[model samples]
Target: MAVVGLPPMGCLPIVITLNSPHGLKQRGCLDSYSSVARNYNKILQNELQFMHNSLAMFGARISYVDIYEPLMEMIQGPKKFGFDKIFNGCCGTGYLETSFLCNPLSYTCPDATKYMFWDSIHPTEKTYYYLFKNTLPILDFLLKD
Candidate 1:
């Protein structure tokens, strides 16, 4: 089994819109929120490590997948991963719109593959593909006999 870590929530479109002083005009992630996510990841990593060690006697194979760094790398360098938009979603304005707000009537970008997020709170398929690709090594290790 592999435990996947949380992505940078501060970089989420909704979070940035709600937390940033400049709102949509803001660039990059909110440091405070990112700090909170980092702290949580640290605790989670430690707990997972402890669980893996303690369960080793029973032959439990547990692995922790660090999704933060790779996701951040993609956000920071979208072009490297064939992505064009990192800060906004492909649905509506890519800022505050989500779920019901980003419905059939909403304005969606022509190419969702170019954006990292599908809506304000969710990632696009392209982003998810990258995340899955990065976790392959961890999954392989955990599944190894």
Candidate 2:
């Protein structure tokens, strides 16, 4: 089994929208929220390591995949990932619209690949592709003996 860590919450469109007036004024993040994710990831990684060792006697394979740094890399370097919008979603205003709010009436961006997020809470397919790429090595290792 694979356990993935949390993404950078400070970069979430909804978080940014509610926390800042400028909203996407810069490709930056709130250290407070992001730090929480970091701390949580550290704890999760440690716990997973404990589980991995503890379960090894039973021949259980539990791996930890880190999406935090990879996502952060995408956020900090959007242009490198072919992403033009790092802080907003592809739907509606790209600020707060998510799930039910993103109805047919809410138009979507022409190119979702250009946006990191598809909605306020979910990442776009392109973002997932990059994240997958970043974690593939660990996944491959898990597949090995």
Q: For model 2, what is the error of residue 21's alpha carbon versus the real structure, in angstroms, after optimal superposition?
A: 4.3
> Taking the tens digit of each residue's C-alpha lDDT, what string does model 1 give over 29-85?
887888888889999999999999999999998888888899899988889988888
In model 1, state the lDDT of residue 85: 82
Candidate 2's residue-wise lDDT over 66-113, tens digit each?
898999888888899999988889999888999999988889999999
lDDT accuracy of residue 41 in candidate 1 = 92
How high a TM-score does candidate 2 get? 0.92
Candidate 2 lDDT score at position 33 = 88
Collision pairs in model 1:
none
Q: 3 in model 1: Cα distance from truth in Å? A: 1.5
